[model samples]
Target: MSKRTAIIDIGSNSARLVIFEKTSRYGFHLICEQKSKVRIGEAAYEKEGYLQPIGIKRAYFTLKSFLHTIDKYQANKTLCIATSALRDAPNGKEFVQWIQKELGLSIKVIDGNKEAKYGGIAAVNLLPISEGISIDIGGGSSDMTLIKHGYIVDTYSLDLGTVRLKELFFDKGVNPSEINEKAKAYIQHELEKLPEHFRHTLAIGIGGTARTLSKGIMKQVAYPLDKLHAFTYNVSEHRSYLDAIPLSSAKNLKRFGLKKNRYDTIREGTLIFNEILSHIGTETVISSAAGVREGVYLEQLLKKDNLKFPSRINPSVTSILDRFQPLVNIQKNQKTKRKLASNLYTVLQQDINDNKQYEKELLWAVKLSSIGQTLTVYRSHQHAFYIAMQELNHGFTHEEILLISFLLRMNEKELLNKPLFTHYKPLLPEKSTLLWLSFIYTLTVLLQEASNNAGITFTYTNKTLRIISDKPLYLAKEKVKALEKPIPFAIIIEDESTLPKNKKLGI
Candidate 1:
């Protein structure tokens, strides 16, 4: 029997539950994740910075749902933590007592510093190659942590986050100058406590505020899937963009391409964001998809000395192949197609390996491009493409998942007139992204050859890729036309006796 553990994070703005199921291998898989945007901080700010009964009621409901989930999963252990809004409330202790007595759920109200610590642990899980300051901008507060050599160096939690900032600054209808004066002073005072060693470090950000900023950049450049995960934006670039927006209405903000729900709060969010960046002399903001709840999971993981803290997501494509094996009869063909893509991946690792994630997602899409046949036999390529792009989930963030799905949905023709993923282009280096996607697509169609029975083997060198195959009458000539697009290297096809002139293919 396996043990399942659950963690509930009841924050000021949103409440979340993350469950981990430990299998026989002793590694835990993310079993379920859910959140409720209860806006607890809104009420806390309204009732003179205290949580109102209405807000508590809504939060209790959310916590009850989490309880049901834990019961359903048969979880043996559960941990619950509440931050900023609850800690600040006069009746917060009573609230915790109320939950324990009424719902039979134990809870802990974590201080700002501890919140910073757990958020740091979670950020450590996400950024394996980075040593930096981790930030989680919650609805009520922003938790900051400095990590070096896998140990927490410094930590803080400021009363500045999306919900709290919006309530205290923007939502009050205060003029921009007055708001900036108050928030800037608060932030500057908070920064005085940060150790000097953390200054100018890479800023790793977690939560909605960070993701909202990332999505805007994604939509701006049409940044494809690969760039979305570890995408970096410096303070200057982000500040200028935020400065231009009025942040009054979603429509006014839509021109910036942020989600409608984000615009009302993002102005204050960005202000606090820029303030922290300037205070710490941060070089860049690395958006981390995991946050508090993941930290709760990591805490349990760390206790066993088998810490996967510094978590790295396998390329979406590789993760899918490893987890969801292709259907029965087609499994063999899928394996061949994957091996073929891997061969190309090995050949081009030099010019293309800046991001293994983008490559893995592409090749993974290619491998399963044939999996949609369970629905019907006809037009499986379209089905497969749709499924690969739209349906698959590899714990991808909202933006990256969207980019991957969009890339899969696009076609060669779609590539010609302003590509669908073009919105994210400005945020990323184009040559690497376009090259990765295009090569993966080309290799996919080549290997599938429209699912023919022909035997083919390809040998790859730094400059060229060689294919040996006997032409089968079953495939369409247009299948070869897919490779006619402009590519840098050459592809040559050799016959059994090596008789036909070596074909030189151009990108």
Candidate 2:
């Protein structure tokens, strides 16, 4: 049976509730999410570091409504965590006690180090990054975690955040130049206290500030894809826009297509972010939509299994399969197709100049090729392409997703060309390489469906390729010939029984 869980993250800037439905052990999807800009840290920075009455009231109402959602979904578990705002406040613990007494809810207040650790965990487990520094800029504090070899190596939390900085300098109506100099000086001083070893070339940005910045950049560049999780940019390439943000007025910011509510703190957030990038000597920044909420859910799930992290499980693939598996019964066939496709790819590697970089994507295409059969057998390949493009949300770069979808959309004798190819040309591999992968996938599926056997083998030369199977090859041979028109080489299919018993086909 499936399970559902809810995680409530009450940060300095906003209170959010995310409900996740677990269709399988490690396969889950976001069912519903709610965010309220309660600004729980509003005026707390200037008000002697106490949880302000208005802020507390806003948080209370947000949580009360979130509880109604938990009851609606019947979430099996609920985790409420408070970050810098609550943890740094003088009356933070007092507020937690009151919430427990009045709202019947228990909130776990985590320190800075723990918050950094959770953010790091979310990045390493979800994003395709192994070595980088994750910067999560919250409303009250910024957390930095140094990750090496897929583990958190060091963590540092600075009292530099959007709300905090805005309260200290920007709200005073200081000129842009003075505000910039003062903020930079303070940021540099705090960052200098950390060890020099924390510097890295890649920086992963989390939290609202990072997400909003990525969206603004995407709009400026007219990026084709609307996805935000893996949106990336070169710091040097976009430095001009980053430099202009602090000086831009609210109207100017809105002209840049920023949300109205985000205008107040975006300037402060951008200044802090640009300073961090400069200090760390980072060249690239990848935006991550997952943060404290995802990290908290993962921590709880892993604890139940007594494991720290999943052992080589792709969360995106698992989640997709969990949702569509009941509609399709092709697991065994999918495995057979993948094996056969891999063997064929190996045999043709020499002729195709294979770099083996796309091997994983080819296998993914094989496993998901038949998913479209659930909807209808007519134009199933097109259906599969649509499903993959729209539904495969995590654990893949934009390029990989497009490549996989394009391969699934291939029909016999179709080669990638202009207009259609131009849309994703920047992210795609060479045309010849894509064609070879598409052919391999098509041939494998056709042969596997035609024959019932434990294994199939292949042999290839510059001019021709041969398929050797233990079973009769009459039907398989016909399909192979029909689909061989796009390939440069001819194909021959033969029964393995015709050969000597001592001979073995290359796999």
Candidate 3:
């Protein structure tokens, strides 16, 4: 049976509640989310770390509203966590007790190290990077985790959140240049205490600051895809844009397409991120939309299994299948198609170097190839392409999602030559590479559907490719021939009937 649970994370800058509907024992997806920028840490740092009455009231009402939402969803469990602000405040425990007595809600105020661990958990489980540094910049503190081989090796939480910095310096009407220098000095001081091994080439950014910066960059580049999670950029390539952010005025920030709600703290966030990149010597940053709240959900979900992370399960694909449950039978059609595609890819791989890394994506495409048929049988591939592009959210980079979508839509050669293909060319692999993979996918589908009680095998030589089937194959050769763009190799197909009666096919 499925279960509904809500995770509420009250940060120094904002309070957010995310409700996840468990689709299976190990699969779940975000069903509802809400956030309020209460700035709970506003002036608290300047005032001896006390929760201001106004901020307290704001957070109380936000939680009250969240309770209503939780009730509406019938969430059987709610995990409420407070980070930075509540944990650092002198009255933090008092406030927790007050909320428990008055609002009938239990709140756990986690320390910095635990906060950092949660951020790492979310990134390591969801994002593509297995070894990197994960950073979550909140309003009051910044959490950094060193991930090695999909596990957290070390964690550090710096008292350098955007809102915390804004309160310390920027809110005092200081010049942008002066604030930038002071913030940089402070950040350098904190980061210098960390061990050198924590500085990694790849940085997975989590929380609102990273998400907002990703949006601004996306707008600047006119990124075709609108998804925020897994959006990546090379730090060196975009250094100037990051540098210009602290000096950008509110009007300019708006012109740059930053969200209005984020305008107040974005400059501080950018400066902090700039300092972080400088300190770590990060090369590339992949933005993640999941953070502490998602991490909390994962904790609850994985507790019974005596595991901290799901083993080799792509949450994004599992969630998609759970929601759609495509008409294709998993044990029969989809599994067979995937097996054939894998076998063909293995044989074809001898001639290709760059396409080897695409094995995971190819498998995802084959698994979801028939999902569009649920929408409409006519032009189902097109529908499937749209669905994959728009809805396959987690565990994939934008390029991977786009490639899978294009591969799924490849029923004819014209689809590859369309204007849409050119528009997304930057995100796609080389045209020849795409054609090879798509051709393999097409052949798998056709061969899987063409004959029953038939086994397919592929053999390749320097200049020729041969396909052998254990049963008589009656597929239209023209369909296969159409995929031969410039014909990389000569092709031949044969059936078991053509072999001598005394001879047996090699396995």
Candidate 4:
């Protein structure tokens, strides 16, 4: 794979270009992305699927502009794939050849199965989902893939989409009731083509319709985090709103917290999405920021690695660490902190209740604890917290991401910030669990800093925490004495060799 690669996805509703820069093998991030609402299948659906001049002109110009942006970035390689729009169009091949002849670009027209597989690959690799049906609803087709145990098991595509339905029913200017009744029956008829096995309780939503709905739900519920990827909501809770979208008038979309740009196709998209969810027995929806573009990139990037990232490797985390913590010693130091934190957590596990469950998050927090120090030493905790909140995005749930942020934000003076905690309280673990993890993480970091990277051990008994070190931890004793405890507990520091013991009073 090239060091810098650009992926172009031409869909019925839009054409998008994304540039990804690799920092390491299996470590990459999006450097730039551009999209145009070409609606290439604009009037083609009603004309026996013939590419019309209006939509063809829009797509041709969009692709031309995209190439300019790709050249500006000097992307080493470019891969372009066209989805439902081009595949369903009678002149799709002519358009592809025309682009090759004129703009020196080649576009691969993928069938519905390939489109669904791409979506599945992206969702499985990027989102924290093992089993679900990845749905990519476009302007002319609804592609789906069944993912189980981190692999795509099956894929299928239906001749149902927003633009297809809009042109078939909505644009006819029929009354909303009659249009919806006709659209629902038509959608159901198309959904019957889906494989009987393409059902799951969780749905991985890909593309614009899913994202728009997720954003609106976030606004409706006042979700704190501004992120769209991996944002999850229960279908039963929002079923009414989903059903109401297609019936909403253009002027009333704002009540659902929708943007005007999406007003053109949001209704049809929502109708298709809602019907599909019901058909597949979907209970939850996890929105994905990645789709065919990312899938196309990853398919090529991980071709040698079985089309999946190596086990236990998260691309986002690897990319951040590769960029920020380049030195071996700094990485070694993080490892050292992780070891100490793990040891402390084990010793104190019996007393912290179910906090043992958060040990994974604790380890990740420890690994990334020092990244902010590279930016500035003063108040690095806040910097680390912000970075974790933003960069620890892919392959992580919202709760896990928020928990890691709170862990990274730990400081000696404060165990937990009240305002910050209160703001994201709903997305976090219980107060007790968070405080325990924070206490353990903060103590481990303090010990490593004060001991000058010396060996350490821990043993907790009878409501007292005992830390034994290979050398005298003089700085550690004072820090421990002034530390804030999550619960009523005592901490004692012991020097390994001979000397009067330094008695540290626990707070």
Candidate 5:
């Protein structure tokens, strides 16, 4: 694979191009994304899967514009694939040949099963999910893949799609309730053929319809974070809202916060999604921003090492560190800092009333704590906070991202930012837990700054923290004295008697 790769996916409803730039052997990020609602499969379902001239013109112009972007980015490689629309069309091969001759671009028409597998690959690698059913409801077909233990187990695609249903029922001059009954019955008939083993507790939603619905749910519930990639909700809790989309009139979609552009097909998409969720016994729905484009890119990127990212490797983290970290290796003592932080967290668990649930997040914070220094030493915590919030995007839950960002924002004077904490309180752990994690993180940073390789030990008893070191820690002692504590705790530094035993250290 080249350093830069562009992936073009032509679905039934729209066409999209995403360019990914690799930062390292195993790290990559999307640099550019463009989409056009070509609706290439328009009127095709009604005409026995024949491509209409109107749809062809729209798709041709979209592809031509996409090529201009591909040139602008100088993408080293381009992978193009078409689903449902072309695969079902009788003259699909003729269109492919026409595009190739005119635009010098090759388009591979993938089967429904391959489409489902692509979505599954994307969900398994990008989202923090191990077992679930990946559902991608496109314009002309709904693709599904069963994932177990972080691998795709089986893939199935149904003829049921938003555009297909819309053309067959919603767009017809029939009664609204009649359309609903017919559409439901049609979706049920298609779902009846799904394997019984596809039923699962979790459902990963991919593609445009899922994203649009997730955005509405986020606004309705006043979700703090605006990110949609990992936004999750209980299927049972939102059943009413999910069921109401199909029932709502076109003129009334604005009340539900749906965009005007999606008015034509959202109802159809939601209806298909709801019926599928009901069929698969899904209790939870996790929205994913990645879909066929990402999966297609990753398929080539990780082909040598199987179709999954290596265990314990987070692409977002690695990409950020690779791009932002100083080449001089400013954080040479990172390993030592992690050790000290881990020790403090473990020893202070009883005092903070924690069960090591956030230990992984704390360690991630430690690794990225110094990255902000590359920008400027003054107010580096703020820089780090912003970077972690923006860059810790993939392979993490909303709660984990918020926690890691909060940990990176701590300073010596204050362990808690009350206003910021209040804003994200709904997604974060208890205030007391956060305060302790911040304190541990700040102290570890201070210790690492004072002595890169000091032999240090920690002990906590009777509301007192004892820091024992082999050599004098004059700077660490002074810094520790001024630091804020989550709870009322005294500090006794046994570092070559740097401080008097009677000195007060608790706040």
Candidate 6:
């Protein structure tokens, strides 16, 4: 356990604060969060690109509330940052200073490039973006970052946002051809300014614009809420959908299923997205739920750890996995055991079933758990756990990494357990853990195939476990320990040294 921290992101269209529960001495939890659509970019871009007094007041009020929330949580540290809206405003600095004085909240107004970086870093934390561009179209500006192999190669903030376009062109809600023309020109100019080397085969979407579109798609198709995670959309289909949502009623539009609050900005967001696609010649979009706030969270982790990024990877994942790398060791030895354990808990699925992805995740854990061991020797289990959690750089949730490590530990001990391992029971319930543990706590002698490491062999007979052997059983003793745990159960060991007879040994 570690101190909790709070992060506040003041974007062009909205403001939000999330309290991240620090998991390890350095890990973070997206414990809880709150958001509001303040339209600061609308205010900034409306009056010749200056922060309007009204917008400033709105932001001040929002920050005041966020500060109270953080205070309520007893968070030890806080950071507030403003993006495109403030960068476009002449009075942005003054507004920040005012907030600093009025609510005792210091706000840092960052430029567009930094905003893009934060967005890209957050995306990298979720899915590996091998090569792509990220576009976050806000109320007043669109941020673009070119990423190749998980690194930010270039960034540009274009002065083209949904609110700004609506204000500049849609006089009395008319589709001003000139506005569209200017938007295209602005986007093209910004794109041209980007390094020619940054063109990508893929594109990642972040910010409110992309998020709102994903929600709209979900509403349009009646998608189930559960798989709303990392949703993917075709650029053309999204563009067509945006085209269907006529411009006039965009602000007060009623799309039946979607939240009313998000209606106004979607049109503008869609327009900007279409233009970005045109500029980059990309027809793909991967929407990410994580953005600057998570980036801020990752930044805090790296700074605290003093961890260096591998020359190849974004430092964000490095800092993240450093706290969870110990869990990958038992992937091979514990999987079938895990599957056996999982089988025992099938009847309980009425209460706690897993997703289709869960088993794959478990299998992945089994394969990767022992990656650190040069050989399957005495301390290999311990070495494997260390490598999985500490040496590996695979981007995973801190919780996921820890859970895998906890499962890996199940394969090493005799009598099926250790005390520190119990902390997991609260998270993974007793039935599930025991089933997984019992399956893993299998004797190699009884399951003779595993003795010569010929291969892993497993079978169960109404609470009894067995393994077929390929060698003499004398060397099978140490391997038996991994198979014997949480007992008052049954065990059987057979070897050629024992005169070719089926035997039974129960403990």
> Best candidate per lDDT, number?
5
* Per-candidate clash tally: 19, 0, 0, 0, 0, 26
List candidate 6 stretches off by more than 4 Å. Answer: 175-192, 222-225, 237-239, 246-248, 251-257, 303-360, 365-466, 469-507
Residues 303-325, model 6: lDDT tens digits:
54332233444332333344443
Per-residue alpha-carbon lDDT of model 3 for 360-428, expressed as tens digits? 888889888778777777888888888887778777788898889888887755437567688888898
Q: For every model shown, what is its TM-score relative to the native structure?
A: 0.68, 0.92, 0.90, 0.96, 0.96, 0.65
Q: Once model 2 is optimally superposed onto the true structure by TM-score, how far is the C-alpha of residue 237 displaced, in angstroms?
A: 1.1
Output the better candidate (2/4) by lDDT: 4
What value does the lDDT take at residue 312 in candidate 3? Answer: 61
Clashing pairs in 4: none
Error of 2 at 433 (Å): 0.9
Query: Cα deviation in Å at residue 71, candidate 3?
Result: 1.5
lDDT of 1 by residue, 375-401 (tens): 665755456556555444334444455
Candidate 2 off by > 4 Å: 304-311, 326-332, 413-420, 473-478, 484-486, 495-507
lDDT of 5 at 298: 88
* C-alpha lDDT of residue 494 in model 1: 55
Give a tens-digit lDDT track for model 5, residues 1-507.
Answer: 799999999999999999999999888888999999999999999899999999999999999999999999999999999999999999999999999999999999999999999999999999989999999999889999999999999999999889999999999854667789989999999999998998998999998899899999998899999889999999888889988889888888898887888999999999999999989999999999998988998899899879988886899888888877766445557788889899999889887766888999999998888778889989989998998888888899999999999989998988999998999999999988898999999999888778647778889988889987766788787789999998888998876465456543331
Worst 10 residues of 1 by lDDT: 309-318
Candidate 3 local lDDT, residue 90: 95
TM-score attained by model 6: 0.65
360: Cα error in model 6, Å:
6.3
Query: TM-score of the candidate numbered 3?
Result: 0.90
lDDT of 2 by residue, 406-507 (tens): 887876545453565777777788877887888888887778767875457888876788888777666767667777344578888767656567766643
Off by over 4 Å in 3: 304-311, 346-357, 412-417, 459-466, 475-507
> In angstroms, what RMSD does candidate 4 have relative to the true structure?
2.8
